[model samples]
Structures are given as structure tokens and as C-alpha cells.
Target: MPDIAPQPGVVEALGQIVGARYVIGPGHDQEPYTTDWRGRYHGRAEAVVKPADAEEVAAVVRFCAENGIAVVPQGGNTGMCGAATPSPSGRSVVLRLDRLNRIRWTSRLGDAIAVDAGCILADVQRAAEAVDRLFPLSLGAEGSCQVGGNLSTNAGGTAVLRYGTMRELCLGLEVVLPDGRLLDLMTALRKDSTGYDVKGMFVGAEGTLGIITGAVLKLFPRPRASAVAMAMAEEPEQVLDLLALARTRLGDRLSSFEVMSRRQVEVIAQHMPDVVIPFGLESGWYALVEISDTLAGDALPPMLEAVLGEALEAGLVGDAIVASSEAQAAGLWRIRHSVSESSKAHGYVVSHDSVVPLEKQAEFIRAVEAAIIAAEPSATVVMHGHVGDGNIHVLGILDPARFASAEALRARAAEISLAVDGVLAPLGGAISAEHGIGVSNRERLRRVANPIELELMRHFKAVLDPQGLMNPGKVLPDALPA
Candidate 1:
């Protein structure tokens, strides 16, 4: 929509591969594809092409490769990082895969399903439910996000404590190489010791290696009974104790153990008034615990209640409430899912998705909060995470009117992030847990990652994409000039 000029014959060549109507030119609505979900990054593209299937996608990539133009593969455009957004130079093509939505096949006996990468994540869950199976890769953005993006980011959601991340959930992948070759490795096998894991390289590559067209994902037996409870504690150590108690009592039945600070709950309640927070914001921290079993009966509720009762008796939990009905359970989860939306609406937020060891999580949070306050005394720090897995999301909210310009705010954010990384490094924590390293953390990764690891990543990128036309300036940092 800006005053950038479109490349000569680029749109026409892409249109020939798909169709003229499918290709969005300079005058069309490219904002949706060019901007990320959080509106943090905006880019310009010579054309946005929507291909119908893998063949058309290959053709488009082939054309882009031949022309030496960058090709950015986008799915649902729900990424937190700027992985899918193209550069502002307007010398790239945005290849959207929304039209490739399809469930190719499903096998309940084999516990696998082959689906097009463009399929909505929730749709895949529903399809698995239809076959009496479960696809447990649940997230807040499942309703609109696509499977391809999830795989690309290696997303870990609320249920990751039980089902693992997308890397563990996926069995195989179908990808289009940078040179336009369709590599079909969509096998629904549980174990295949055949050579190196070529498919694994593309799982979290953020479309830098190639564009994922389809996937064969693993499924599990659907849980027939479940119980949800919210417990309040005076401190994070108490929450960690409660997690240990729940796991000891419930064993593998425990599916999710989410911890949220009082500020996090207040943010949700303030923005989403309709969401019911059963317990008021008086405690220092809260934990949302869920346990499930394959047997359908009332036993699960009593088991959860017993666990909470024990935590209370042990002086670990100050207050607790168990959901009495399905609607009530959904309402509790609604509060958790509303955190991101409400935080964005609250103010300019600087967020981090880092993972620390379970024993170090409490200390990690304390140190990061102190660092944020030291950096900006007025910044309100809110925290939450899947404590069972040690992936915590820390956010610092600031008033937009205080900063003179966006660059000023970004500089402050970068300072805070560096302070956070400093705290995490000593405690043996990672800068990124679920979210992949897009442009947002590309430089951070280079600074924090081992030199040999970065070199190997560059080697792989060079071998797979010799021309460096696939999703340039993402994941790995730009190569230094000779």
C-alpha cells in the first residue's frame, strides 16, 4: 500500500503459476499478509501469491529461485516473531499457503494423521476427535493458527507438559526445497532408523531451509475424563511445591500445570470483564492444574480435590477452587487464554519466552522482575508460564505517552531484554523456549549461542539454499561480508 513500485514481470510470472486473481498486486490488500499478528513488524512485497496445492507452491518457489528473489512462506500469519514478514525493500514474494488446507488421510489404528500444512490447528484437533483420537498440541491461537506455523516455530502450548512440542508431535513432513523440488517424506511411522533426520531440520527452520507443504502428525488416545482446579499460593516456591504435590498424587494423569502472577490475573480481569476469576487477586501467585484419564467417571474430580486438600494442609496452597462443571472449566481456561490479548490492549509490552530449570524457575522470575524494575522503575512486570516444563513468559508493560518515539521504546526494550538474558545465562536457561528465533531474536541468538553451533547452522543454510532466497534475514543472523 505504500508508494513502492512493483517488480517488472514478477507478478505476471507468479500469476501464471497460480492465477491472476490469486496474486495480490500493489493495489490490493497486502497489509494482512505483510504485517505480523501483533503489528510489531510490517514489510513490503512485490506480490502476495496464494497457491492451491503443493505443486503450485513448488512452481512459485521455482520461479522465485530462478529470478533470485526472496520468498517468504506464511501460514495464518499468527507468528509472534517477524519470521513470516518480508523485508521493506519490496524485492520479495509473500507465498501464502491458506488455500492448501486439507486433511489428506487419517488412521486411528496407526495413531497418525496426514494433513496439509495450511489446515487450521483446531480443525486438526476436531478431526482427531472425530476418529476417537487426540491431537494434544493445544495453544491459545489454535483457533486461527495453521499447522505449518506451529511446526515451524516448534510451538509449545498449555498441554505441552503432557503431549510435548510440535517437534515431538510431528512424525514426518512434506517440503518444497529452495530449488523447487518437492521432497515427500510424509510417512506415518512411529520409528524409522533410516539415515539422518532430514525432516527434523525443517521442523523449526522458520521457512529458512524450505517451505513445509504437508505433515504426518502423531495422535493419542483421547482422554475421557478430566478435572480442572485453580490454586493460589503466597509465592512461586509454594506454587512449585504444589506442582510437586499434584504430580505425586496424580502421576501421568496431570496434563497441565500453569503458573500466573497476581498481576497477570489482574490484567485479564481488567481487560476481559466477562471472564470469571473465581478467586480474587489477593494472593501473590496462582496455579491452574488439570488432570485427565481415559476412564470416564467421577473419580477424577475427587482425585483432584484430594490433591488440593493435601496442598492446603501442607501450607503450600492458600486457597483453591475446583471446577464443578464443563462450562466452569472452560471459563477458567478462558482467563488463561485471554492473557496475550489483554496484555497487548493494556500498553506497550516487552515480552520474553524463556525456559529455566524447574528448580531455578522461582529464582529466575525474581531476578528478571528485579532487573526490569531496575531498568525502568515505572515498568509493570507480569509473569506466567507452564511451570511443569519451566517455560515462563515475562512481560514488561510501559506507558506509550512517556516515550518520545517508537525507537526510544525499542531501545529500552532491548536493554531490558539484555538484562533478562544476563540473569538467565547464569541459571542455565534459554532465551527462547517455544518461539523460534526469527528476526526478533536473531541477533540475540548470535550473541548467546555457541560459535560452533552458529557456524553449523550457517553451513546447513548455505547447503540447502545456496542463493539465500528463502526467507532471508530470519532465524540466523545475516552473514558478515568478506
Candidate 2:
């Protein structure tokens, strides 16, 4: 595909907006900014613009709006899909938000923090913890990802079962509208029954509506004491039974419940040698569960022992091991964190982050496996996810030695995704669960999203970003000409 060029004057116009030092055009300066994390998509951009503050961002957007040039907002570029990268056509400018990084204000009194869009997620977590609070939205890319990207995607992580997604954790936002107007509505208040709750329209809009400058995030009290356990299960079904038992016994204290298949465990053990497993025995599936002690000086050992005992007697759990100390707990988490890295070691794979209703969680995983096997007899499917929220990361593995062509493997994976979508259609599940619908899943969104909901989305985008200059070709399908 040929690169898309903008009007002859777009580059010069942008240069005037943010100054020459901040604006980078084609050549060595722009080469490093062209690719994404997964190496799935690559495209050239006319220039990479770094705006230091909201004013510069607004100026750039206004210039693009006036010149009819499309703008693609990019932060950290840690997104799985090519949502952050410019399209193959080298016409658009990549508006990089890394320079906007800053910690504006944080309140220990009400458990809220205000941070710039470019602030790294890990930094935010540390800042919150410094004040004896927790910012629990965690993922594999937390170290490099930014708050803007999280809010834009409404990211969900292991803590979502307890703290909720980024949407729930967020209390306010400050955005730069498409036409260069600033929407300064960053109120860190909890209750405001004022009007339409307009701030929400851009929360998960995936940068289609506007460029998010900063946000106020809700925080929670840090867990006093934490316990981690690993349990073996006969199948995914047994895992569900174990969850019911744990919930009934542990109540709201359950912090994490991650389910992994035997295939996932085998790969992790093989690829990541540093991560140690307590037992040598194998099982059909496994769950790495965690609970937090809310009360001060509370004894967590007895509570954990009681739940494991009941799980064993009922045959819902096969075998279990609780972490003896904090060091052991970190080791268990390392195993869970290495899942994606292990899959990469196997060969080319297609990763899907989707969520089904909790009640049908086990059935959903089984159906995906069966459906993929039925569709492609040679395909190998490995499943792992935050089972507490019914969100599974289904990976289709293809041995590079057997299938030398990466393109062929990706094609097969896309077919499997289509089949998975067919299964999820009736269940009202999400195609892009934690990962937002970037350029990769835009078409799928059109196919699976409810029509009325999509209409509302389109109308809102049209109103806020009428010029279509904010992250064009993302979150929404290309607009049809009248």
C-alpha cells in the first residue's frame, strides 16, 4: 500500500504550531516511531509531533482541523493493535504524547490522583502507594503504558474483579477537542448528578473523539496483608466450581483469580526457567488465586487453609500450594506475568483479549477451543485469563518450524477469531476486552457491536471531532461519504 500524503501545507502548518524542535519529519528522526509493540503493523508518518502541554496539543489539532489533515494520537504505543501507529499511507502525523508526562496533583485525603496523559502506569502506581493507597489497574505493559492509553481503552487487568476497569477508577478528564477547543472538566468529585455525564463519551472512545491530556483516577486503601495460592484443577469446569467455593468462603476479600491451562503452564515452565513451580506433577488446568486481609493484624493463614480444605474435599480442586512468604508470592506472580513471553517463544501466535459473562466463563473457554479446533485442525489453542472477570486471553500458537510463513499463521488466526466472534455473538461478549479496538478490530466492531450503540458512538464522534482529526481510523470505521 502506498503512503497517504496530506495537503502540501500540512507539515509546515504543524511546524508553526509546536515549533521546529518538537516537530519531526521523515528520515532517521521518524523511523523509530513507525512500529507497534506486537510487530503486527508498520506504517510511515510525515512527521512525529511531541506536544509538551495541552496548549501545544490544542494548537496542533486546530492546525490539522483547518488544513483537513488527519491526526493520530499516540501514547507509549504499548497497545496490542496498531491503534497508535499511523496507517500505511504516510500522510498523517503521529501526535506523540510522551512529552506531556507529569504528575499534576494527588490527594491522600479522598483517594484520588491527577496525572498527565503521558505519565507511565508504573510510576502512577508507585506514587499512589507512597501515600498508603493503591492504584490497582495492572497489566504486562504497565511499565511502559501511559494513563491516557489506559483511559482511552478502558483497560481491565487482574485487579478489575475488585477495583474495576479504568472507567470505574477514573473520576475526571481534561481533553483537547478535535477543533482545538479545550474541555477542562477534571473534577475529582465522586458524586455530581449534574447532566449527561458527557465525560464518559471519550473514556473508551479510543482517541476518536479527542486527545485526553490528563485524568483524575480513583484509588483504594492498600491491602494490609496478602496471600497467594496455586491450585490444580481437572478442567475449566472444576475451576468455576472452585471460584464459587472461594467466593462463598472468602467473600469480598478475593483479590485475584487467574486461570491457566496445562498448555500455558507447560510453555511458561519451559520458556521462563527463572519462574519456579512448587510441584512436579501436572494437571489439566490451574488457578493462581490471591486474597487480601482487610482488617489490621488479621491472621490470613487460617482463612486460606479453610478455603483450600473445602475445595479439596469437594473435589473441585485437585491439589494446592499457598505461598509461604512474600518472596514466594512474587514467584507465583512471575509465572502468571510470563504467559505472553512464553507464547512468543513457541512461535507466531494470535492473541485475543475478550470477556464473557462470569456465569458462562468455563463454557466460553471450552467453546473457543472446540470452535478453533473444528475450524482449523492443525491449530493449537492455549488459554489464560483473569477468570474472576470471565476475561480470557486466548492465544493461537503456530510452530515456526512447521509453519514457516508468519502471514499464513496470522491468516489462520484471523479465521479463528471470526469463528470466536460467531460464538460470542449470542452471548453479547466483547471482542476487544482489555485491549481496545484499534485498527485491527475496527471491522469486527462493526459486525458485533449493537447498531444503536454504534450510532450513538458515531454521532458523538461527529459532534466532538467534526473534522475527524483526532486519531483518525481508530475506534470507529471510516465514515461514509454522503
Best by lDDT: 1
Worst 10 residues of 1 by lDDT: 473-482
* Deviation (Å) of 427 in candidate 1: 0.9
Models, CA RMSD each: 1.5, 2.3
| Candidate 1 lDDT, 1-482, residue by residue in tens | 45477768988988999999999986549889888888888888889999999999999999988888899999999887889998777788999999999999999999999999999999999999999999998888999999999999999999999889999999989999999999999998888998999999999899999999999999999999999999999989999989888888889999999988999999998898888888888999989999999888999999999999988999999889899999999988888888899898889888888899999988998999999999888888999888899999999988778899999998998888888888988898888888888888887787688899989999999999999888998988773210
Q: Give the TM-score of candidate 1.
A: 0.98
- The digit string of per-residue lDDT tens for model 2 on 231-342 reads 9988788898888888889888898899888888888888888889776547888898999965765477678878998989989887998988899989888888888888
What's the distance in Å from true for residue 247, model 2? Answer: 1.5
| TM accuracy, model 2 | 0.94
Cα-based lDDT for every prediction? 0.90, 0.83
